[model samples]
Target: MNEPFVRSGNRHRPLSEARARAARFAGALQDLGIGHGDRYAIVMRNEISYLEANLGAAAIGAVPVPVNWHWTGTDLEHLLTDSGSKVAVVHSDLIPAVEAHMPPGMRIVEAGVPAEIREVYGLGDVPLTGRHPVMDDLIDQTEPAVATDQAPPLAVIYTSGTTGLAKGILRDPVRPEAVPGMMRSLSDLFGLQPGYTTVLPAPLYHSAPNINMISAAALGMNIIIMPRFDAEEFLRLVDRYHVDSVQMVPTMFVRMLRLPKEVRDKYDVSSLKSVVHAAAPCPPDVKRAMIDWFGPIVKEYYGGSEGGAWVQCTTEEWLAHPGTVGKPAGGAAIRILGPDRQELPVGETGVIYGRPADYWPDFTYLNDDAKRREIDGGDGFITVGDVGRVDEDGYLYLSDRLNDMVISGGVNIYPAEIEACLLRLEGVKDAAVFGIPDPEMGESLAAHVELVPGAKVTADDVRGHVQRSLARYKVPKVVVFEERLPREDTGKLFKRRLKEKYRPAEGNA
Candidate 1:
């Protein structure tokens, strides 16, 4: 625990150093009027300061709201305003874009862009707003505040906004006595332990990675924060650091699997003990390939930002129950409910709902209490609009989000099925399937495909490939090729953007 606990580029900071800085930051926050229960926004990529900001906010019982740096215009304004964030900690280089949208009276703290991040994104000569308080200077000038004994306030996490505007999930704060149980749940779910070296390549704005980072810090584990995800560099870091457990998403697995055999083989990833994934439904083929490559260490959990992981499966369990996300985890319960809100029998598709473990605090969508009541099953469970079924053995298998389901020609179609089939096609790097307006069928499936570099597949090739594997009705009526698909590093696709192109004009059908 005394060793350097966090690494970014060539810089390494130990947990003790981080704690001291966090305390100083807490004092600075108090001076700036951010107190217990007040929210502060963190707008940055994966970096040491991102971790520090979260820790500092938590030290004084304040909540940290991590904002996705990619958002702009209304999306950005909506989050800052909706969360009622009293302050925002932004990277100096990002000030130009963020400053314009920041709400009036919200304070700003600039975390200077590290060279590693600037280099990775190929940033050059980005100007900063010199008017804001610098994070380092604040820490230096402020006196360390006595850390609070109460458990930290739950962070205000926003949804991925794939369907619409992101909603802030404001969870109830954990009582001090409940801290140990919550920590144990987090440790078990994330495969973290004290002193275990790990690498974090996913963006910190996402819930899974953000939670992982916080838990890893609490356990005093050695941490390596990648500026951004680079398939080769990830392998190299694992080899160099002799890292143990690491969390990832299915998209990263796909990218690494696409690497040339020699390139993937060059790194000694044998040191990896656990490789965990979640955030989206992983295609079976991709999961099988990952298990084969990473040994039996590939594990997965199914949950959302609303509640902690409620279902999980180890590699062995997953192999036994191929597509299952696993039985209820950590004393949680799952139920698949049909249209009438009655629980469906095993093997029947319906909206997936779960009662999270008692250790997880209850939550409501900020400024949308009625929406929270809408999802409540009224039987002690809640759903996030996912569609799935459970096997006789009680293992859950995900189909797709309820919003993503398309009814065409009076037949229901789940885009995840077609997307998985498309991924199996040769040279297909990524694909997104969603419903689009159609006169005859009411709505037709549209597939947006991203091919591997040098791939020369035509729209016909894409459509024919789907036709060969899946039912004709599931094959997308409109096939469009793109250089790349709009997706989060966490594997959530923004299909709304793709579907917007097909929206009918106001006066026309």
Candidate 2:
């Protein structure tokens, strides 16, 4: 029987057999035309096979490009075309939803379907072809137990370019030796003990969760997976499975905390050993509120989708620094540099940069190499265009993307700072800030907010909240309620989407 990684009504994959399955899947891919250095993209929800394919592809030197499952078919097509992917494997259930977006002449594979879609593998429920013509099946597979490959690179995850079209960040596979450092810091932050099972909460296609998943598998930790995020059900599932850890983004944390206190206490979550929060700047108030309820198990990580630029903080350090993203990890060098790429002194804001022991060889846009080399300083450093500052102790605090920073009447406003303050307001549940063209101020600030369920907070109330937390000039001129703010796969707020939807034309304004 297969170890069921997906836990809905059916959770069967035990931790023991997951590796065996990855080898089986790797062999399947090789037989399906995958080879060393080939590129294959996966666009699906959370499942064990996601990890299997990721590591499996790495083993064969085929690059795994995990596209955000929420993207429209057009969005996925961009990734498929941009990455020059040779083949694709998808969830049959989502096929109809994005089938029209698929490009012609692409080889396709499916795991779950109506049994009529020829050549389907009904993931978890059905088995693979027992014998295929692929070479020494076991040898062709990347050793499921070993993932670190400093050379050819692992996977290329695309950023949800809410500010622009998605840009891909290639990840170098981590080694068992590097696992100790990442796991030690992560375990210390999450309060984990030996033999804890962590649920892959965030989608594994993204960097943070992908790293956490592979490390968990190698460390012999049990793994559970969620197909997608559903707040109420997340709590129920946690209680039902007694999950110890999950890679989470702040977006989900706010929704879970907003659930009535009664609804929160409904589950027995004492088994939770740790929770990893990264891919966004979590608000200090949000962090504090969670500590009050869930204890000090939240671990904050500040790293780019690109290889460098990292800062991690634990719940305890977070309580002390409040907004700090902790000190560096992985023996990787971290720095704060000005626009000129010169190292900034403590207290000065600059672009955060990092050079991992092993970094992206050919960094930037896949088809657009010029755009890629633009961010690669060629000095062995990569900056994702985020502007930040380092304090005396080296804790990192982000302002916003260098280009996304808003200037109104000569004062610079960082959208993240405003968004953080917005999360604390009564009625506002989530917020995204962007700059819109303003005849008066060059570029004025605007916000799209998601309100707490049925809270009935109006635009004026939100205005008051922003006024209280920030400078008068920094307040948003527009505060529109959104059923949901557009977000990337990595849980980063898509300020680009908000700006496009609300910004007026140059003359229209």
Candidate 3:
């Protein structure tokens, strides 16, 4: 029986069909001179073909590089050249944007955008320009690749490049023997098991969601893919399909929580067994509200693409330790280090450095080993530049990104603390806080806020609200209201963009 399937919008394909297409695509890649450990880029929105292309490449031990669709210009060129991708499977509509950036000798395969995505994005149907081979046609013309026992190499996941240029993460291929242990750890981290049904609303380009898709397929779980995240539509899919598990980020939680009570209560979500979240720091209030709404099924994990999930907490554990992301798990080791690289006392905020469970393989930045060495904390631990500390009970609390810390007038400030406070206000919809140049103090705080529609919230109101709970210096000196703050679809705040606005003149700084 074809018990497991992958559904996107109105289209559903049995896993068997998907596997067959993947084998054909793998054969096509090999025919194009792609070899084991070679790379191919996938540049499309969430769709069935994306899955086929990714799986096809991995089937023959080739690495798939999932490029963020939002990327253009140098960011796009850099990733294509950096990954050394021999072929790029791009969406038909997105061809124009990427055509100019294609590196010399790289092949292009166009995949048509599905109706569900076209309707939502209001994208008009564009016939293929025929400048490159089509993915479906290639699959039809090629033969199925031979099966193999060797484990597939992981995708080359690039960092968000918030501080600088994007760097691709290259990991050692998993050994077939280690597959069992790694699968167990993944199942634990995601709270998923085989034969379950799961929904994925997050972008496949992100590391966690990408890994989730691969793992769910491996475990024979039915997968439902959303073209894009819509708070109400998400509920409808879960209720309609009786989805057993789902993964999300903090922003999604905020959007769902903000929905009217009547709209939220319209759909039955009792079928959900596990709801996991990570990728950004979630406010305590937001998390608590989700737990209250979704029952004790809400869970969270803490880690990065570099290490996978090293720490996680359940609903009960989070309730016991408010604001904690949870203690280390999966045989992981963690530390809070000060500027001197000395271990800090309990509850002292500092740079967080750690390694995930041994089941995960070590990785380095592609083409840049020196940068990887920079993050290596002695004794095999790697720091991802996050700032946090552990409590007396060993539960970790995230402060903010280490690069985002503001040193103003000789006092250290963590913007995440203030941003969380801003979100608690009635009218505030979103907020971003960062340091700006101040001639007298070296740096000063600036707060950019997005308010609920029709809500009358002034700059003073924002500062006053923050002052009530935080120190005087923590309050923003400059407050600006924005219709919407710059944020990634994955829910990570793009503070680097905000910082660029206040960047000092090249000669002045």
Candidate 4:
């Protein structure tokens, strides 16, 4: 177990104490009649208890399923239902989300122990306190936390649902043994040392830092947890804590660079060793700026929660290949396959597949076996449905998602959802929305449309229709009138041609 891990905001948790709390929590879970192998959903923002819940669940052999903190009731309700998770350990602030669509028979347990979590589910007379039901006194509280080497389902993270409703990436970790394997490539690439202090600005609810926490803790590194990322405060924390490593979405790096020059130089950043960028694509310009400012310290990783996160491109490597995800990960194999599942020749864009002999945790999609078929090539090879090409040097370059999902301002937006809404408008005939690049926003959505014959419609009308149907981020910024959308020989709209036609933010039309 990890010893010297620190949490963000007010609480500082010592791992040994965290281990004790896990034992108590485990006992409390048993009092609720939760048995080994049962799934417990931990739906709280980043905090000390995330560590506790994970450890406590591990202590008792119960599974811990972390809910994505950003997901609303509409989004979260489906995940909890799909995972079959009852007995939610939730944060007081997020009681509303839990209130909306909690499983009918599921029990609600507050997460943080010292404080009374604020939600009331009306099923309680007196809140259940500590393990052992109603014992005023407790024994074995000081019992050494014993961990088994059993490979059990540790946690389940949903697939973000950028393309559709989220599905589970059910994980089975064997006594933190799988931790080192994932960290090995990253550690070796960045030269991470045991004494290195790492600042985790990303949410721990996600896979990147969830695994990073286990890896850093086992290696005896000081893991600094942030409640959420704030660009200015992140720099301040790094300066104060002598932070050596940081991992974030490429957008975070862009936002940090946006800060005033005076603010950027206010802190001493010499302790920074490497910054890992994930979650979305990094524009070539942004990557180059980071390299120029920090000397090739910005590292880019291209992977997904569905097992293959091996494709990586460092800032310096991008300078050479100019946009290529550096050579395949050691012992990890990638093949770019065409639509027919045939291997594509070099310079041909296709779906990238990977099969790593080890370091791949047993990732299975919960409940829906059909969804599982999409990612797995069977016999260990998996693809996350990303489209990309391979250069002569074995480096990979992602073109887009074959499904035409639009990513705007670093957040993913689905065209099918937007198009479905646009079709509802009275004057609309046909519609398609896609992303185009911008320096500020990594990309922006542009909707191309064909109006019903002689029916007048403006961009604002179409934009208004989309905003009402979906989240504000999904709305298109520009709308273009098209006589007809250009199509390939197969009658499919050629998205590459569409993107090339409608560039970012308009250069004076």
Candidate 5:
């Protein structure tokens, strides 16, 4: 069997070497009394060590909880305690920030920042603090341990926590009988196959990329990992490596489209075969432009971390149906239900629920069973609070999030519709719409926009643009310009934060 080659920036390592390190780390973990069913935390930026830590945990039948390194202070503390992490593997530079927040008796293992990472981020020669046992030293001194034959536990991924505190989604071990089918479905959805060369520009901590890299490694596909995403550099790497496929989000497409024509045309990206995008809705115009640039190879899948991929659409299918997120894949069933738990008529928007017809590994909200029960829509179908409708042919169209809908004078208004219209206007880079309290109407629409570089627009201009396309009631009562909007690395907007900022204070209305 051929070994997979994994590269991040200028650093490269074969899968064999990574496996050796993982085995040694697994030995060290075992020495520390961590094994099957145990949980550990991994807090670091994208690097080869990230994979090593994850694989090492799997070797011992332990679970690795990938924490968003961007979190710090109380947020970081909450995760360590909530997950009951026995140990923490952190990047050297991040140790100081988390040191005071970690739970008592939890061991710490520090990974030195690689030269490639420092050069890319322009952090020159910062020495390791030697505050804890170094990961490399532990790996070098410890003998490799034999891996267990037992099925490894899955990572406990946390939700985005748009409504409140994040909840961990914990899955039971995969049944051996279901492994092959699961792998086949994943391989088809992600376009992973032997000898395929893939690039993962999204953060490894994200659910999609986390699953993507593991699947790619299992399939013996050469993988390129980006420490940070740059519009032009992505195209350059694809051309340089003769990349065959990639996974990206709609924000990436917008950034690539904004690049200068000459700069975009410079790279030879014809080698790409499949480019799958998700994590958020893609505007129709943006999807059309991406198809034009990358051919019909661009595809999309819709699912949450809890449910896995349910529906998928090819560029052709999307062209035919425009905004549909594709019909169900992997024999998954989708249903739109109204407030009374009754099935809504076709084309009538309501809460979207989905589940696989075959085997889907059962999951729970770690330590929060009540939260899991709340999402259950009866008969084993579950929803993540998304509001959407199914077409006559069964393709799904997301109207907006149930939590994000605005009630103005008792009329329902979906922010996604207004945001889509805002995206079409010239000079608009990004837009977010939400509800704010209004004395007369109970609630009113408010828009926050980010403009393209060197572009100028006014609140009236934005209002007029929407007025021309949508109903006057749908137009935002207030429009505010921003230098940039808060978004996750995966292109998901932190709209809850925006909503909080605009939400009326008690007694203000």
Candidate 6:
């Protein structure tokens, strides 16, 4: 197939060209002594070459590990050493961040910063110091590597490290017989199909987008990638490309909704057939607005990097049950269990566990088998530490991560519910709720809010808003304003960072 993968702000790469480049990349890695089971890191932005590098590594049975381009210093060092990555394919601009901390003798392949990426980041077009090999030159000089029959393995996706250090989730190589089932599951969850045109606006380094891109390429879909997500530009791309589907997070929906009515009305997004969102729990109001604006195309799923199982919900299902994440996809099942590991009755809140349908592969935590054991609740059920409950109709409603729940006077408080309420208030751009020490209550809820540009809002305004919607105790005991909040590109808030900042010192009342 000669279908093209278009990178917004850059040129299109035909599938044939992409395949050839991937093969050459595989040949080059083989020349550098990379072999089966070896891991290499790709620390670049959202560019076509990022996918090419991944394909190349798979061609030779080597796994390509995608590093979050935003990581630096100790986090960067820890990932590189922990994964035992032998080579790093880095963008020209990001080399500076990796040079000081890269593992010894690690080969570096520098991808030149494309003008599009430079423009997005406001970087100047500058020459590299020639300390590392250029990716293009290597591809041009090497012949395509011979293909292997080995089943490709899943990429090692690291967790967000909210509770502690990031751990790589590794899966066994895909069984050849399981390929069809795996593809079907991915297509069902991501809305991917052959010959369809789709836009991927999230960062490629993110697990969902990375897997989606790989699936799109394999399916011969016309792929349009954005260097960075701009709310208006996304709408324009859908109209311009007649984009049929997309995968996004809730934050993108919020940003798009924040656009003026005229700006939102300017684009014709009727071409969208499937708009799937995951990675975070979307506010019910925000999701309802999107379904109204985009028709019933908006869908949602709940899963993790562990590759165990997934739960999905359609627009009609969501509208029917309003906050439910829908029922588990065919073959999958969800179980809510209390602290003692006994299954909880429907409508009772507890930890959520999932078991993959018959077709999915099992995974392990790289270098940390004990961690894997902890998540496994026996009988093939595993959880990522989320707290939620299933309704009478068997639809799941997420409360919050088990680690993020606050216990004040023996009452469990889910910050996500409060944050959702905070987002509904006018002038509130973003919010994070967590618990802090209190002498009397043992713990008290604290909120940090980011306001819309030039928005005039106060702590009392936020407290009153929450109080009107929820229990008085749910209203944050303390509210702080900020110009911005720490959020990952995928829309996950770094509440761990905020909690650490407000943690009371030992012995302090």
Tens digits of per-residue lDDT, candidate 3, 372-458, equal: 998888887889999999999999999899889999999999998999899889898889999999999999999999999999999
Clash counts for the predictions, in order: 0, 12, 0, 0, 0, 0
Candidate scoring better on TM-score of 2 and 5? 5
Residue-wise lDDT of candidate 6 within 261-353, one digit each (tens)? 999999999999999999988888889899889999898988788854378899999999999888988688899999999999989999999
lDDT of 2 at 294: 75
Compare candidates 3 and 4 on lDDT and give the better one. Answer: 3
Which pairs of residues collide in model 4? none
Q: lDDT scores for all predictions?
A: 0.89, 0.69, 0.89, 0.69, 0.89, 0.88
What candidate 1 gets wrong by more than 4 Å, as runs, is: 1-4, 126-128
Taking all chains together, the TM-score of candidate 2 against the true structure is 0.83
lDDT (C-alpha) at residue 156 in model 1: 91
User: C-alpha displacement of 296 in model 1, angstroms?
Assistant: 0.8
Candidate number with the higher TM-score (1 or 4): 1
Model 5 weakest 10-residue run by lDDT: 354-363
RMSD of 1: 1.3
Provide the clash count, candidate 6: 0
Q: What is the per-residue lDDT of model 1 for residues 116-186, given as tens digits with 9 covering 90 to 100?
A: 88889998665556889999899999998777776666889999899899999999988666778889988
Superposition TM-score, candidate 6 onto the true structure: 0.97
Task: For model 3, give the 10-residue run with minimal summed lDDT.
Answer: 145-154
Please give the lDDT score at residue 345 for candidate 6. Answer: 98
TM-score of each prediction: 0.98, 0.83, 0.98, 0.73, 0.97, 0.97
What's the lDDT of the predicted structure labeled candidate 4? 0.69
RMSD of each: 1.3, 5.5, 1.3, 11.5, 1.6, 1.6
Off by over 4 Å in 2: 1-9, 96-99, 113-152, 171-194, 357-365, 377-379, 488-490, 502-509
Error of 2 at 362 (Å): 7.9
